[model samples]
Target: MTRVLRAGVAGAGVFGGYHANKYKQASDIDFVGIYDLDIERAQTAATAHGVAAFDDLDAFLSSIDVLTIATPAFAHAAVALAALEKGIHVYTEKPLAVTSRDGEAMVAMAAEKGLVLACGHQERAVFEAMGLYDVPEKPLRLEAVRNGTASTRNLDVSVVLDLMIHDLDLAISLAGCEAGGLQATGRRREDEGYSAVGGDEVNAEVDFENGMKAVFRASRMAAERERTMRIVYPSGTVFIDLLNRKFENGTPFALNSDFAEADIARDPLGTSVFRFLDTVLGVRDRPLCTGAEALQALELGFAIDEDVAF
Candidate 1:
């Protein structure tokens, strides 16, 4: 029988709870419990999942072979570093860290320890299902829009980190090269109650080293949820409606509709979790989303947030 790896969560809140449930459903892993600053919430979440809650961070870290850090973006680096130092495989939610420096540290430690480190950039799975990765020609231009109604979730950072980062990751992946630089403008927040130091609505134009260009617009104060992308190549264009979970290939390449229901349904978190576990267990050749990749995306996002002046 394949050994079931012990898995635990670092936060008992929104994404943490979601991840806990995923761990329960995944057959190769045992849902151990959660560790959080709020002991009560952790205990409650643990009870709901039929697992033990930990008030003691060390105890929680010691008990699990894999720790998924679904804490706030700012806290990711610290929690990831602790778990990585303890030789535990780590997977963190997106926008790896508030700062590129912290993100780089997490990636470095994972490499040093030879432990699997993955990021929760789930949208890549959507593209994978669309066979977007197999598009023959490099994109000359790309456009992305990711908007969602105001929510109290992930308010620790601006809309760029919370919402736009997803599209930014995708743009970079499709561009398939390092970014040269970018130009951006953003609003702090129209919703007074949800504003942060990091702003909420942002639009950026990125120039890639390989001559591909991308324009990304993300807003958390949107009236309706939207997630869409368009990639332009010499031959034709590819348009993907992420929210609708389908794509239209204006190009000649025969893109497959052979994707599974879950993939097409846009619940890539399950796929992301599966990939993370596979990487940790050495069953997968490589991570679908790596710490370093997330770090690069974070760096670009910060640049957009801070470098508005050309």
Candidate 2:
């Protein structure tokens, strides 16, 4: 039997708690506990899950060999570095870090320590399960839209980091190549004040070395929710309405035709967690999302933010 791993989660917010629940339900995990700036919140989650609650970050770091960081974007690098320095495996939520330099540093630290450093680009799992990578040919163009109603939740970073990073990571995964050059433009929501901290809408066009191109649109100001992607290949088109949980695999080279109605919920986060465990347990050689890949996405996101007209 595989040995159980002791695990801890930093941050007690929605995503942190969600990660905690995943650890609790996994048979290979001995869920150690949680930590948060608000000790009360940590205790509440700890009590509910029957795990230890730590008020001190160092103590929490000492308690577990594996950690999931669901903290804010700006704090991801610091926490991940600390965990890696302590020889702890880390699975952090997306954007890796607010700056590319920090993302690079985190990646370097993990490499130095030989720790499993994974990022929560969970959306990649669903796309992979759907076989988005097996297109009949290299995509001439790829398009994506991920928009939703405004929320105060993740305003610490731009929409490019808060929301667009998902699609950007997916864009890289589907293209299966490094992006070359990109041009971008954006504006904040009209209703917000002039000093608003982050953008509400953003757009970018990325060029691949092989002459393939991809365009992305992300907005947090939409009245409705939508998450979709359209990949154009020589054979045909693959259209995915991620919000509606449906996709039309229009290629003549059919893969999974009934994917939309396939009863299984598209729970990529679960898949991401399992992949992290697999890496830590030595069952897999690499995580689903590596630090280098997350860093690449962060670098591209910063490039996309450069032309923001707002």
Count backbone clashes in candidate 2: 0
Q: Candidate 2: where are CA atoms >4 Å away?
A: 190-196, 260-265
Tens-digit per-residue lDDT, 161-247, candidate 2 = 888899889888767788898888888766635334567799889997777799999998889888989988888888898887788
**Per-residue accuracy of model 1 over 45-70 as CA lDDT, tens digit each:** 99999999987889999899998898
Superposed model 1: Cα runs more than 4 Å off: 190-194, 258-266
Q: How close is candidate 2 to the true structure, as a TM-score?
A: 0.95
Alpha-carbon lDDT, every model:
0.85, 0.84
Q: What is the alpha-carbon RMSD of candidate 1 to the true structure?
A: 1.9
Clashes within 3 Å, all models in order: 0, 0
Q: What's the C-alpha lDDT at position 193 in model 1?
A: 55
Cα TM-score per model: 0.95, 0.95
